[model samples]
Target: MATQLPVINLMGPTASGKTALACELYARGNYELISVDSALVYQDMDIGTAKPTKEEQQLYPHHLIDIITPLEVYSAAEFVTDATALIDQIHARGKTPILVGGTMLYFKALLEGLSDHLPSADIHVRADIEQQAAEQGWESVYAELQRVDPQAAIKFKPSDKQRIIRALEVYRLTGEPITQLQAKQVKNQPYSYAFQNYALLPDRAELHARIELRLQKMWKIGFLNEVEFLMEKYDLNDNLPAARSVGYRQALDFLQKSDRSLKNKAVMEEKSLFATRQLAKRQYTWLRSLQQTHQFNVYLSIEQAQEDLRNLYG
Candidate 1:
């Protein structure tokens, strides 16, 4: 019997030190970084994504960053495919793959393969759904989900527009609940490799403070200007996936306003911070769910992570 190689998953909330821990591990050699982030996939959307600096990337290369344009949609299904491939490639190169990011959907999809029976996303159908959301409201759409697929509807709030729309789309296309379809998915257990998961679970107040400081820094470093440039370059609209990302969405709302008053700017900052903290809350929920099935080397601080990984790799 041969020992299996390990594939590391470094997961945490928005402002957690997952990236820094991954980078430190990479600095020690024999590790390749693969970003699991949904937002970091977009090219030239660096500032708001908290993307690694160009110099940092040059020194410690990360795969799957800047692989798509802002206009393009990158799904979790696609992420599973890409990440699986990258895992193989990195192993072949005699390096361990470290998957790191806050995008819990991507992590979940990769951990458990998506159902093949589920229908592919229909652009026209999705457009119709979006139009419905625009004309009506997400509450109405969520109501539709509840009416059609109550089981799925219970899993998401009305504010979870993306998943709500997806469930409705799946229901409309296949006449089946997305939850039912998901139940049929084959659990992805890599026979040749083991997943060693690490979670950075900071205290809520501590995490909130980090989020506040991070967003304040983003604003200082021209995050709004970056959003402005992306909007102009891509002809972006509020409906686009990239435009709807946490900070970018709030910034878009702020910029589209006729008045760029200080009060309005303050509101934008407040909203963006709230959205980011909400994102962290959702991530914590995912982490808890993941904990139900998978074991993680949990750490509440970067020093703890460093100490653990040092022992593992040293």
Candidate 2:
């Protein structure tokens, strides 16, 4: 019997060259690229997401990109289902699957199954929580989660309003801590794939520089215009995940300002850059945690990753 090829995971923080490496592997033949990004799933979110250009995508196709609109939601559970099916299909076709992107939550859910007991979003419950947040602020909400589920609360900061809300919601629905449920349920079924993980873990200084440069390039390419167009085209609000994306959120704030002066624009740019850096910090934390749990090839430089992968795959 022929041994099934291991699924390769090329993961990193934003602007860490995961996509470039995946494309190179695709060019080598008998491999399919599967994007694990949350933002890249939404259509018309091209520039801010740094989605592959049409030409690049044409040459090296990627599954799970532009699969939904900004108005819709794509949860980590959905990603696990979709990605699992795609992995099976690719393997049956006699090709290795290269799952690549920065969304660690999706990757985590795929590796460790989510709790089936966790309730889905209850509109009324969510509305009540949002109202409370609007009245008492997210700090109050985070405090409440800390009281109810400190294990989960420790993972998120107060500024992480979406996650805080969801954690509290899970508690309200199940009368159990989300962390406990996850730890209990995730062990019931083990994932089947033989995963070969690779993570790009650049130095902090190098990553911050790359983030700043990427944000500047996004602005130069009219990211604000893209946000404006999406706002006009869809019924978007701050609550939507797409609207809350790193660059898009800052761009929306800038567009809503009454004064579009150069000074304010610079301020918006700084805010966006800071938000992106924070995002990279969170990604690094996730990658490091995954590395400890899983067998991962960690690279300090994209050049090093390229050379190693080339020697192994090219």
Clashes of each: 0, 0
Model 1: per-residue Cα lDDT over 144-207, one tens digit each: 9999999987788788888888898899999999999889988975547788999999989999
Q: What is the TM-score of each candidate against the true structure?
A: 0.95, 0.93
- Which residue pairs come into collision in candidate 2? none
Q: Indicate the residue-level lDDT of 144 in model 1.
A: 90
Q: How far is candidate 2 from the true structure (C-alpha RMSD, Å)?
A: 2.1
Model 2, CA-based lDDT: 0.87
Candidate 1 positional error at 85, Å? 0.7
Tens digits of per-residue lDDT, candidate 2, 174-257, equal 899988877777642355678889998888898899888888898888888898889899866566778888888887877886
lDDT for 79 (candidate 1): 87
lDDT of each: 0.89, 0.87
C-alpha displacement of 2 in model 2, angstroms?
A: 8.4
Q: Can you list the residue pairs that collide in candidate 1? A: none
